[model samples]
Structures are given as structure tokens and as C-alpha cells.
Target chain A: MATKDILSPLPGTFYRKPSPDAAPYKNEGDVVKKGDVIGLIEVMKSFHEVQSDADGTIASFVAENEEPVMAGQPLITLNI
Target chain B: MTRKVNTLFIANRGEIAVRIIRAAKELRLKTVQAHSVADTESLAVKLADVAVNIGSPAASKSYLNVEAVVAAAVASGADAVHPGYGFLAENARFAEAVEAAGLIFVGPTPHQIRMMGDKVSALEAAIAAGVPTVPGSRGRVETPEDAAKVVELTGFPVMIKASAGGGGRGIRVANSRDEFDRLMPQASAEALAAFGDGGLYIEKFVASARHVEVQVLGDGYDVVHFFERECSLQRRRQKVWEEAPAAMLPEDVRARLCQSAVNLAKAVNYRGAGTIEYLYDETTRDFYFLEMNTRIQVEHPVTEMITGFDLVREMIRIAMGERLRMRQSDIVMRGHAIECRINAEDPAKGFMPAPGTIESLTIPGGAGVRFDTLLYQGYTVPPFYDSLLGKLIVWDENRDAALDRMQRALKELTIGGLKTTKPLHLALAADPDVRAARFDTQFLEAWLEHRAAMLEDH
Candidate 1:
């Protein structure tokens, strides 16, 4: 079966790193476990951590850091 | 720094934006409206001097987009921006951007917004001003152990509140240490999801308290209270019915309540119209400062009706650097006024948002009646914004007369397309305790639950 990609559950600004000048939580080709925080999404001054529900190797990052993203948009492609 | 505001851009939608446009027109200021895809044909857009499409229907891409709104203002040559409640109304960053663009931000300064936006800090300011606030932690606590210690000091039945929370989100009641332990993580998670800050604070929970608030106006230096409003009729911490000159308040208690509101506003050097909310325990006859809404409140019209003052007009004038036209002694409470928020929700179905086209519309009218709505016969109530479709307000010689008028108005009003809170208002009007003015914050919820159970019983 093909690996499932992680998606943003809410509409907000996507952030690859927790804060400016910090390394991203996950990157391409990195193996991630279920519930591992992959990125952050901020909506109306609120930030929600986007987690990978399925453990898999990261295929690609669908959205750039600090860019606006919509609900149900793909954040990352994964290879189980 | 007093600049003449000839044109104002309203960066919002719904009844509030319409309210602002009407006030601007009264002031002879040209109005520019910014709309998202959801509000292309909204009443505010249709009524403005010019309407500019900002972006998509989603708030993040449209209404809340500060750059888009500012761009629209610049393009339309608007000298000032009126962010009519919600969206970017309290957004400090957006306010700063408006100032940087050389456009007036028709609210408090950025510093004031940031300082008052955080609940913990605002509470600290209230305490420093000697305002009576519920005793609790001075700042946000990080761990369960910290929360427990704070709870112990504040005693049992404490409320865990998110520092960055509002609109009834990110709040949990902890009856004991075990409950605190069970709810802390959930509260933090919800807070982090709702507000960017997961910081939590504890406060003594005052059960069965009346939600009384004092309205104040300021021009940066001078501040005055326009008296108080009782908003005890609420569901899930959201107010439904609000009336001015809160009934059952002693003369001394009322004076103290209004004075405390003025003291806090002066301490902050507040500007424009704001509401200082308080929790009044009728049993103890004591009041505690809850929080200050640094923008025009949704129920401001009730206070306006009784005081014979136009609050929105005052906000615009204050933004233009005009001094308050009236003083404390000049302000007089003329009559009783009550406002009922008409929301597009099904009260029987758990207050679920009922968004659809209005197939038919008939607003109530008569003596001492006013309906501030944006709904037309074919108007489609979009699910993008708040559920409040309009406000039905009435005024009379006394509270009883006002209540009777409200009941009649509710009966005359009709929106055939979708379910609304009209039935709920009807039930509230018929409740004995509510009619007698003995109800508190929990009255509406309890009454609704009882009604639902009775419906099930039948």
C-alpha cells in the first residue's frame, strides 16, 4: 500500500520551524513516527502542531515555510 | 496630529460593518467597503460608496488579511480604517500596519491592544489599578504542580483560563486537583490550537454570578462611564440578552461598579468606546472586574438607546481626535432598553449554525422598536463568519415594558429559510424567573436543557 501524506487539519500560515532561526522539525527523506510533529499552522494568532499520523519516510514537503495553507491541504508526502 | 478623516474604509462584514458605514455617512465621511468572496453582495458592500473585492471567502485569505485590507484602503484613497468588531478589530499588528500606511486605525493604539489582549496581563493591570478581580495566580502556570498550588491558594472550583483565549474558548473548570490534572492537558491543547499561546492561569470561579458590564468612552485622557448593562442571559459563556441599567443593583453598588470601570480605563489611558466586564454575585452584592473589551461591544446599542448617545458615532469622532461631546453629568439614563442577538442557529439542535438562503423576511416594527439586520429575502447567510445575523433591540419606559416589546417584536419577526434563535428568545421571554429579573448566567443554559428534556418527555 502507498504511504499516506500528512495534511493540515486547519487553515493557517504553515511554519516549518518552531521559531525563526531554528531548524525545521522534519525534513525530506527523514523517517517520521506517528504523532511526530512535522510542522506548525497558525490561525488567528493560534498555532496548532501538525503531526504525522502514519510513520513513514518523508517524500516531499508540499508547502513552504511561513506560507498560507488551507484546510485539508497536503503538508508532506510520505513513503512507508 | 489631528487630521480630517474624509474617507473611511471598513475592513469587515455583517451588521457591524453596516453599522459603521451608517455612522460614517451620518458624519458625511465617504465610506469604502472591502469584501471577501463570501460577502460580495452583502448589505454593507451594497450600501458603501465603493466596494473592493479583497480575496477568497476564507477569513485567512480575505477578511483577516491585513495586507489585502490595507491595499484596498490605499487603492480606494481611504484616510482611515474601521475594523468593525471581530476579524482584525483587535489585531495589534494590523493596527500597526494601518498606522504605518498613514491611515488612521479607528481603535486603540497598538500598545494598548497588545497590553490588554493578554488576559493574564490585563488582570495584572486591573489588580494594579485596585480593581476588584477574583484572587488567583498572578501569571500563567506551566506545570500541573504549579496549577495545583495556585488552585490551593485560590481554593476549590477554580477556572483554568488560557491567557490568549476569548469568545468562550480555552476555558475549563477544575473542581479539585484530580479534575485539574484531567483537564490541564486538554485545556492547554485546546488553547494552543485556539490561540497561539498555551499559557494557562487559574482564577476563583464565581458560580451563579450576573454578567454586568460598564460602558466607557475615552479620548486618550478623559474617560467616563455611560452606566452598566446586565448580560446575565447567556449560554456557554456567550451573552444572548443584554439590558441597560442593570436591575436589582443598589445605588452604592452601581456607583462602585461604574467607578472601577472608569479607574481601569484611566489607568490604561484608553481611547474610543470600550466595555469593562464584571462578574457580580447577587448573593454577596459584590462585583469583580472580569476583562475589558477594547473595542465597541456587540450590545453597545442597548446602552446607546438608554443613554440617548450614539456610541458608533462617538467611536468615529474619537478616532478623528474629537473630544467627547458629553460629560458624566451630561449623560442621563432615559429609559430601559434590551437587545436580543438574532443568531442563525438551531437552538433545538444544539445551536448548530443554520446557514442558508433567506426565502422570506419580515422584520418587526412599531413604537420603540429597532432591527439592525443585513438579511434580505434572497440573502444567503454564509457560514464563514459569526452566527449573529442581526440584533433586535427595543426600548420603553421600564424593564417590563421593554421585555413586553421584545416579546412582541420576536413574534412579529420571521426568517423562513432556516432555523434561528427566535424560539429560544420566545422561551426566555416566557420564563418566570427571567421575566422577574432574577436570572443569572446559567439561567439560559438550564432553561434550554429543561425545554429539550420536556420536548423529549412529550
Candidate 2:
């Protein structure tokens, strides 16, 4: 019914994979459920999981891997 | 040749930006405020003559991003950069970048930063310059087994500290052998978590220690001291209250502390504003060098209020290659000054950072009362940066009078629709130990714990 974008809940470095050598939590164009973990935001040595809020087809990631991001900045756009 | 800096680019945020802008304007120099996208409406932007969007609100990508900051300075046509304290202040790469971009770095040289940045190297430098330092492990204790050797040498009641940590994080005090055995791994884990380095060092813990520091100014040749400031009142390793002309130090000890700071400054060929921190054991009356901060300190207002010198203005002038006019003897301390850091924190709730919009503000005033802040009505306090909203400094002819004035000032000041640590400061100013100027770095934490227990009983 609507297209929504996932925004980082805090300001920090956005990590695509769980670890440097691990596979990314979600890839572009992959369908993600509402509870799926999409990325991680690391701030002040603490990490917070950025989860998908809506179950939708993956549109594209706005923030690159290991990029610094601010709170409320777009991380991924989901096309429902 | 020393070049004239006509315009200064401040690569910082919050009240420090406002402080630097006012100082720059006083010298008739054009000021450029570097702001993140979040700080577009900050007071520094309003006060400065020009504003440049550096980057995002995240410090690592904005104020701390050397390339972005240097680019902003270049774009704004600034001839010099004052990093201010905290973000990128001690970063040698940022200083080198500013100088490489043909702009004056308002603090120390990159070499000086590197020499003093690392805790081990700074201790070595202090020893080399004949500045007495706390006895500890010569280098990092790589393993837990190595820690015991240091403990045997330093004895029990040892302090385990991270080599790359500051602002009080990465430190754990172990009192006995059992505690030391239990805490070494914990301390190393925290150090690795905080600074990405598990490198830990051990030092003999000073039980009755007073945090005293000497403020120094240098021109890469001559160095001058601004006496001392006592920052014994701290919370979780951060200073809560600061005062100049430290209370109750012997005259000879004061002379030695000042001279030791000067010795280290001259040894490093330090330039601009700097501070040499010392841990003074009250019982033994021995002072050991802590570390050298190669930037203008947050508590500089205390020294300025007492010595009547514009430290920020002098920093700008020195960056422009102008010689310091006043000799060490010419600078005099006439009055005692105390400063309370007005942070946007909820003291009752364990000093949690309470960031929100200020609906209104009523500041204290009159003679000897100085409120340095960027806060105003309708401004939102961003949660991204430091919790500091401003500094409340009061000055008087003596310590007793200064303390009394600070109590009155704390009462008169109010910020509507925001929870702050004003109530806690009011309590501190009234406390018996604080009134008597008797405190150590652990005083605030103990006081806070005591207050919580008292409230629980009620």
C-alpha cells in the first residue's frame, strides 16, 4: 500500500554484516520480514540492531557498508 | 616566518564555539563557525560572522573528520583553525592537516600532540624533562601474568589504566591481591572495548589524592604558568566542579608543580594553550605528573577569572605569530574563582544525559558572575554531542567568598522544561566538605551515593 524507508535510530557507523567476515544480514532485492535484522549501528562502542519495520520487497540501501550515519537518516528504502 | 591569521575557523560545537567566536571578535578577527547538519541553528552559527556546513551530526564524520573540517576551513577562506577541546583537539593528524592546508593550527604542533597523546610516551617525556610522575609499569602489561609483576612492585591498592584512554574511562582500582586478580581481566576487557586496545598499565594508587593542574602558555620557546586549578570534585572520572588557586597546598609544593609543568612545556617546545595535570597525594604531599592536554581546557574560565587573562584571545594571537606580552611575573592571581559545569543532565537519575528543548532560561548575573553558554529559549539540546550546556563561574577575593557566591549564583539560575544538575550543584556548594574545600576525585560519586541513600530513607 505504501513505500517506506528504514532510518537509523541513532547516530553511528552503519555495519552491513554481523562481523567483517560474515555474510550481510540482508542483501539488496531480497524480501525481508518486518522483524528481520537489516543492519547495525555502532555508537560509542555500543551496537544497536537496525531492524526492518515493514514486511516488504527490498528496494535499495541508502547508506553504504561501514558508513557513518546520523539519527533518522535513511538507511534503506522498502517497496511494499 | 610567523603569518597573520585574519580569519579563524572553529572546528567544534556547543558553548566552546560561542566562547571562541566571542574571543575572535574581540581581537577584530573574522570568525567562521563549522557546524554539522544537526547544528544548523546552534548559537555558534548565530554568533559567528560566517558559518560552514562541515558534515553530519556524528562527530567522527563531522567535527572529528579532518578532511571534511580542513575542507570547510579552506572553503570558508579561514587562515587558522582552533579545534577547541574534546573533538579532534588532541588529534595530531588534524593539526597536520590544518598546517598542510596553509592554515595555522591554534594549538600545539603535531609533534607535541603525538608526544603527549600516548600515556606511556607522555610519562617518558615527563621523566625526560625531570617532571616527577607516578611510578607504574614502564609500558603496557600485555598479559594478566605481567600485571602481577607490576602489582608486586607497586604493591596492593594499585590502579589499572588503559594506555589510550582519557576522561576517566578505562580505569579500575584494585585494593587487595584477590581484587587485583579478579579485576585485571575486567579492566583489560573494558580498555579493549573503549579504546580498542587492551594495553593496561599499573600504578600505585594514591588514596588521598587531589587533582591539581597548572595552566601553561608557550610560544615554542618561552613558557609561562597561570598557577593551578583544583578539580578534585569529579563524577565517574569527569570534573564536576573546578577552582583556581588550589586550596591548601604548601607554597613550595605549588612552586614545584608550576615549575614541573613549565619544564615539560619547554621540553616539548609547546605552543598555545596547554594544561599539565597532576595527582597530588594529600597525605604524603607528593605531586606526580598526570598528562599534558595540548589544547585549551574546559575549566580555563577558572584560571581566566583569577589571572585576568583572555586565554582564548591569547590562543588566537599566538596562532597569528604574535608574542605573548605578559611575562610570568606580570600575570597575577588576584582572586579565587570557582566554576560549575552546567551540563544538560538528570542528576537525580544518575546524571543521565537529558537532551531536549529549553522552553526558557533565567541566568545568574552581577559582579564576578560569568555564565558562558550557547543555550537560549526555544533551542533544542542535541543528544549527539557532549551534555555540557554552559559553565557557571563565580569569582571573589577569597575561597570562602567564592564558594558563597557560587551557592547564590546556582540558586538564581534556572532553566524551564529541562532537568539539569543545578540541584546537585546547589547541594555541593552547601555540603560541609565542599565548603571547606576538602575533596578528592571520588568525592562527587560518594556524595551522590550518600544522597541517594538519604532520599531512600526519607
For model 2 chain B, the run of ten residues with the poorest summed lDDT: B449-458
Regions more than 4 Å wrong, model 1: A1-80, B139-202, B453-458
Chain B only, TM-score of each candidate: 0.88, 0.89
lDDT of each: 0.87, 0.88
Model 1, residue A73: what's the lDDT? 92
Residues B362-441, candidate 2: write the lDDT tens digits: 99998899999989999987766778889999999999999899999988898877677888788888889889988888
Candidate 1 lDDT tens digits, B224-250: 999999999987778898999898899
Model 2: residues with Cα > 4 Å off, grouped in runs: A1-80, B140-202, B453-458
Candidate 2 global TM-score: 0.81
